[model samples]
Target: MGRGPSIEGRKNAADAQKAKKFTKFIREITIAARVGGGDPIANPRLRLAIDKALTANMTKDTIERALKRGTGEGATEQVVEIRYEGYGPGGVAVMVDCMTDNPTRTVADVRAAFSRNGGNLGTSGSVAFQFTKTGEIIFDIRETPALEEKIMEVALEAGADDVLSEDGFIDVLTSPDSYLGVKAAFEKAGLAPIDSDVVMRPATRAALDGEAAAQMNKLIARLEELDDVQDVHHNADLPA
Candidate 1:
């Protein structure tokens, strides 16, 4: 009989995963500061990025260094943001957001991930039409009872598009332009959110299961593993 995976191996894998997540968080913080300015108060995107980094237990020194790099105090290479559109297994529309200094290498890595996982790279706007960009703020239901009523009253008044409550959380949606305002309103109301971000949401979902679903998951995981890739969005509705 084959031996089970070693404990040390699992530990190493988990550590590697954590390190990758940290790298992505750092990149986001740096890019946000670079594009929007290093001051969080004046830069809503940077503020969100810093909040996420803090929530993930990133050190203050690490964040400060990234901010310095962003603001040209300790800068080296120039990192630019790019988006890749594609289709994954089972015709699932996919979008990848990346921050890279080398577009050539990033594109090649992304293309290879898609092709090897039974997917195809697409031209710009290929699958972008299938999604809508929106600002989302999520609050834990346990921390905010009567979440729906409270969120609706505050969010809608502040130009939010919708407030949805499910499971143990509430999600408030807003137009990209209204995101900062809505977030400020919630913060001023003393209803601090657990997570907030501007994201691409699928206008329609593609259902996939078994082999197709597995393949799609593999594709997404692979893309996410790339150093330059920041986020991966897809329309595939898999098992919860």
Candidate 2:
């Protein structure tokens, strides 16, 4: 019954979200360059981070600045990467990856998010065994026998582990080590992926509905809203 958000308010929210995304991208780029080298050609991690930044429409100059900060050519903040494993509503396994300057604050905030959302924080390795790290590339194309065959041929030849067609999308799964190579092969073959990433895939999913599902969604949203949280992975299968 009340008035909805005005256009300016919506625009402001969108702009803020974009800024947050860019900040996260820059942080990832800086860390990758710092861990590896500034040269994308030589540093696979940095190369992937650069690709993501470009795909997100990030400016080259901004990326260069982040690289400089990483390589010590410019001032940089000291941030630590941490992983937190937990369980959300309906006993769904959850994993969170974060980069933060304050570990104490980050942990406290994460724990609170879980507690407030009918979940609880877990010790390291508690929920990690439920997942496997793998690379996944998804193409937003209508499923067809011929198209599936072509995609499978290309992906397999590129060293992908498997190709699957379902729900009008094509999936190319690969080992972590072969992810970059497979992605490059797809690009050369003019197959652009709508989404691709190396992620922690859950082996099993917990089905939730009604109140539990709502709580799980809130838990995820809360974790994502934390400034230091980077990635959130879960094994909750909720109704659409």
Model 2, 87-184: lDDT tens digits are 99988999999999999999999999999999999999999999999899998777444566667888999999988788888989999778889998
Write the residue-wise lDDT of candidate 1 on 112-188 in tens digits. Answer: 99999999999999999998989999988875577668777999899999988888788999987688789989989
Which ten-residue region of model 2 has the weakest summed lDDT?
141-150
Question: Which sections of candidate 2 miss by over 4 Å?
Answer: 1-3, 143-145
Enumerate residue pairs that collide in model 2: none
Q: For this target, which candidate reaches the highest TM-score against the unseen true structure?
A: 2
lDDT score of residue 43 within candidate 2: 91
Alpha-carbon deviation at 61 in model 2, angstroms: 0.9
> How close is every model to the real structure, measured as TM-score?
0.82, 0.93
Instruction: Name the regions of candidate 1 deviating beyond 4 angstroms.
Output: 1-11, 139-147, 157-159, 166-169, 177-196
